[model samples]
Target: MTFKNAFMITLTAGSILASHLTQAGSPVHITVKNLSDQEMYYQSTSAMTQAHASPTPELLIKGKGSDEFRVTNPALPDVTTASLRYTIGNKTCEFRTSYIRTIAPGGLFSGKLNTAPKWDKKAISSGNATCTVTVTSTNFSDHSWSVVFTMK
Candidate 1:
């Protein structure tokens, strides 16, 4: 092959690789911690509608323990929020938060929390709940990310 042809082929290959890298998104690692004395249930059904990325299965977080899951290839500019529900006795309390935006590919992009989670006054609930949400860039090369939610 001519030198010119070889150079053109190398340039084309490099361009394709770069294009793929640019389109690549980071997988988000999600963790939910139940800091209260009672078990908590994380429902993704409602949040899934607004979520750009979310865990596939619903989670049950034990009291004073945590559960973890992952979301693959979250798109950039992710505006995902979390909704947590807890049942103590006959009363069930639910808390929803504002969107936590993550624009960067990778490091801590944004962290948000509602220390005093709003409870539905109309619902007959009995409990005090707090929620925290954090989004961080874990790896840059592969664009790995982490999203942590803590409930107390």
Candidate 2:
């Protein structure tokens, strides 16, 4: 969530929630913080940018089969159900694959990635890709919430 703007850098965080319930009001509570060398102030982005980070429902697809992963309904509000894929090396293997159906504000969904995916370890040292969560349209949302995480 890092944005480059001269001497200042900004990081913004929001959540994505997908379920079969009703979306009453707003979905995400967003905040912007400025990390800069100079004493800079916080200025919000246009509604267009906010719309990008806002959470929406989509497919929990995975594996080479790309199946629809299921979860209990009526999931908590202000949360995200993310299907994360972490690769080991340049080859990009599917390490850990699951849905984090809840991401409360100021909280991190932490877990150990699959160091050894269902691949041949002896023959292959590592094969992996970036951690990307692609949102799919559900009965709730006509659109999808898609975001890409930059590998560090």
Q: Which candidate is the best by TM-score?
A: 1
Q: How badly does each model clash, as a count of residue pairs?
A: 2, 9
lDDT at position 48, candidate 2: 28
Q: Give residue 34's error in model 1 in angstroms.
A: 0.6
Q: Which 10 consecutive positions of candidate 2 have the poorest summed lDDT?
A: 116-125
- Prediction 1 global C-alpha lDDT: 0.51
Q: Per-residue alpha-carbon lDDT of model 1 for 1-152, expressed as tens digits?
A: 99999999999999987766555233456666677887677554465422533545345667788776654433332333434555544445554433333333333444633122111111123555455566543454444556666666
User: lDDT per prediction?
Assistant: 0.51, 0.25
The residue pairs that clash in candidate 1, if any, are 26-143, 107-137
What root-mean-square deviation over C-alphas does model 2 reach?
22.2
lDDT of 2 by residue, 1-152 (tens): 33465224322212223322444222222111112222222122233222333342122212321222222213333333322232322433221112223323432445533221110101111333233332232223311132222221
